[model samples]
Target: MFFTRKAFPVQFNEHLPLNTLIENIVFTVFDTETTGFQVASTDRLIEVAAVTVKGCQVQSSDTFRLYVNPERQISQEITELTTITNEQVAGAPFALEAIEQFFDFVQRNETSCLVGHYVAFDVLVLKNELKRSKFHLKKLQHIDTLDLIGFLAPSFDMRDLEKYAQAFGTRIYPRHQALGDALTTAYLFVELLGHLKDRGYSTWGDLLQVTNSPARHLSF
Candidate 1:
């Protein structure tokens, strides 16, 4: 059954204390493959993937991946990029079921914030999906690895995930697939975290300060 907003209330910890060390913080890194880029209408998710990270390492056992039946035809361009086909998702669960599982997976830790590459798009798609299910996501905190990379390496061209992975030496096996991209984001995040740590940013507050700095503007 699809969850209603009242049934599954997500809690946001945006203002929560961030005194804890980064090493002890739990992060739920995720990625999604969708039918298209238009989040305001029509587009739907075809796949979702997530991994839990702590102490700068991914918990191999703690992962989530789901192929969702988008209920619409996928474009050939999208298929070429993500390699997801209608036949592959024909027998899979629908959006609501897959979203329920994703919520449960991330909600395992209340303090865990979401991490993604160009995360806004993924979040927008998830929000739209939840609205379809008559639910809404709580205002949760998130970190964008793309933004972090921009802040750290301003000279690097922020083109695509492949560029970021190659520049940072993060392995992206089977690129464009949900799980593969999520794993690659996790590795890139860990490396970025190390850079932040070396720059004396050891707590979530410190990281947020940098991310929200007025001087740091992100493009792409």
Candidate 2:
């Protein structure tokens, strides 16, 4: 069943004040494995994963991951990168079904901040897929770890998640998979939150204000 934009009401919890402590805030860290880079063109999502964090800790039981049948052939290069072959997704649910489950998972924590590394790309792909499926996600507040890392370490290469993880002394095993990346980002986010706290960013608003500063010019 396709859900129209108005099918689900925007829950009131999403408006929770941002003045609360950062460690106390709930966060939903997610990642997507897509067919290609361009969301406006032919790219499609093949996999997605989300993990919940609260009190600066990852909740393993609250994780969600799914393989999506893109309804198109998986490219050889993509297969090489993600190790998600065409055969693996042959019986998987299509984008519409998979996204529905994803939405359900997210709605469980309507007020949680959405998080990812290079998050804009993942969010764009998800939004585009929802549009194509005739569904709409409730507007979400997002935190991009890439932007945070860029602000903190201007000289380091911010595009590579592995590099950032290494700098933080975090390990991202089985990299490139959706779940693995999400877990890695969650760890990096926790570490970044510590640095932000040390720099007087105790509230969600404080962190957002700093990351959105004009001087940073963070693209992610």
Candidate 3:
């Protein structure tokens, strides 16, 4: 039987000390593939994937990927972009159950923060899904790689992930696949942190100072 959101009693996240070393913090860099961008109402998650970054390293062995059965016909356009077939998710776990497994993965890794490119949208997608079950997510600590890129290059206009990865000389991965994008973002995230460190942002507090401005960080 599927459990309600509250039935999962794992502490998958924590508010770390401000002075915590950046190397000591575990970051869950994640991505979601959805039916579309209208997450607040119609769009639903088709896939969710994350990779763990610890001590300035991407732990390739530590990864999580889940295919969520949206229970609705996926549009042909979305299927083309994400290459996710109705058949693939037909027998997959529903949103709540898949998310529970995701939380379990996060709990096992003891993640301190979540990272994504334009992460607010993905968070919203998750929020709306939980709201369907009358559940809600607590305020989460999240960082956007897009914001980091903006910080590094304020005049850069292209907001595309692949573009940023290319410009930054980071590893490029298969587009639209959830896990592949997560891995790409993981490498990009570590590369961005290296740049931040060069600019004297090495501690959790230092990182927060730069990223905590209004419209900089997303709280769920």
Candidate 4:
């Protein structure tokens, strides 16, 4: 499928009030499945999904999921790992169109922040897709659940998403598939926020300190 290039509305993450309570922020917890991890050159995005969270709750009715046609063959190893066969994405929209829709969903959800398991990688995946179409990701206000976990439990070292979910006792969904992982991550994100609140980090600024801290960086 071909998509004509068009401008997408800015996410405006910097405009949100830092004084707002963390619970009051609307977070769009999202995940992506890609052709591979080398997003800058060869790997392309295959699927993206997101769930909304407000007041530390997953808003079930507000969700987004899309499979993207990568215009390339799906490697057998990836299909085995993700269960996303080439046939599944044959009729799907291409990366640019699918991403535009994803951005539209974010706008419609009134998201104040974006959350993900390993958010920097996912952000890079999206940026590469946009760059392919001569578009730029101007700014993204995002939080990594991975970083939050580091800040909250510096002694805990497991970096796998399901392991962290199991350790935190959050809901576990089917692994690898975009929406299922997104749902799992969303629940885990909320749980992490609860722990942060217990430590008196209850405001947007406070949460930012934890996520933005250089010490919170995890190798995973």
Clashes of each: 0, 0, 0, 0
Q: List, residue by residue over 39-151, the lDDT tens digit for candidate 4.
A: 89999999999999988899877889999999998899999989999999999999989988987888887787788987778888887888788776655678889889989
What are the TM-scores, per candidate, against the unseen true structure? 0.88, 0.87, 0.92, 0.91
Which 10-residue window in model 3 sums to the lowest lDDT?
Answer: 3-12
Candidate 2 clashes between residue pairs 3 or more apart in a chain or in different chains: none
Q: Better model by TM-score, 1 or 4?
A: 4
- Can you give the lDDT of residue 195 in candidate 1? 90
RMSD in angstroms, all models? 4.4, 4.0, 3.4, 4.4
lDDT of 2 by residue, 1-220 (tens): 8444533233324455679788778788889998888766788999999898889887867899999998899999999999999999889998878877886787787536788888888878877887786656555667788778877777887588898899999757578899999999988988888888887789877877766733222121
Model 3: per-residue lDDT, tens digit, 173-211? Answer: 889999999999999999999999998888998887777
Report lDDT (CA) for all predictions.
0.80, 0.79, 0.84, 0.85
Worst 10 residues of 1 by lDDT: 211-220
Q: Which ten residues in a row have the lowest lDDT in candidate 4?
A: 211-220
lDDT by residue (tens digit), candidate 1, 1-220: 8543533465533455678788878888899999998856999999999988889887757788999999999999999989999899999999989988887887775445788888888888887887777776555778888778877898887658888888888767578899988988888889889898998888977877767633222111
State, as a TM-score between 0 and 1, how close model 1 is to the true structure: 0.88
Better of 2 and 3 by TM-score: 3
Q: What is the lDDT of residue 155 in candidate 1?
A: 89
| Ten contiguous residues with the weakest lDDT in model 2 | 211-220
